[model samples]
Target: MENEDIWPPKCPECGSPKVDYERQSEYTGGGYADYWDEFQCRKCEFTWRSDKKTSYF
Candidate 1:
């Protein structure tokens, strides 16, 4: 319930609510990338998008 205002804006890799702009690790073949997706967790470094910003993968 840390980020209740945003509800479930969490990282699936670490369950952290520290999501932000996609990290540079993603372009370097970080193993997590998607079409139209551009968000990542500052804690676990997981990347993803949602809703209208959802990924094709």
Candidate 2:
């Protein structure tokens, strides 16, 4: 994806704009699991995820 499509999300805890995308994981088998992309805040060390099957990043 292009850089514009994968823009970093803000930190929910501190509302910091200096957030970074860490990684992503998706369930391969037919089991129940959530697809998500991990992110971290550079300012506060806050971590979070976007639990969507289809992610922009």
Candidate 3:
């Protein structure tokens, strides 16, 4: 894997750079897939993190 960004990274959205980060469960049903660092933009609802580095929700 590549070097991942640290917590409180810039928001991929709005680009406001104001971001909120938290640890959340990342399992669907089976065993724990992994923990994720969820990030939310202060401006928009656009949220993402280490878990969805390629997409946004």
Give the count of colliding residue pairs in each prediction.
0, 0, 0
lDDT of 2 by residue, 1-57 (tens): 546454677788998889888656665555644467789999999888876674333
Please name the candidate that would achieve the greatest lDDT relative to the true structure.
Answer: 2
How displaced is residue 33 in candidate 2, in Å?
10
Q: How close is candidate 2 to the true structure, as a TM-score?
A: 0.59
Please give the CA lDDT of all the candidate structures. Answer: 0.57, 0.73, 0.66
- Candidate 3 positional error at 22, Å: 0.7
Model 3 scores a TM of 0.53
| Model 2: per-residue Cα lDDT at residue 3 | 65
Q: Which candidate is the best by TM-score?
A: 2
Q: Ranking by lDDT, best first?
A: 2, 3, 1
- Kindly give the stretch of ten consecutive residues in candidate 1 with the minimal lDDT sum: 22-31
For 1-57, candidate 3 gives per-residue lDDT tens digits of 854564577767566777888876545444434566878887887888675322222
Clashes of 2: 0
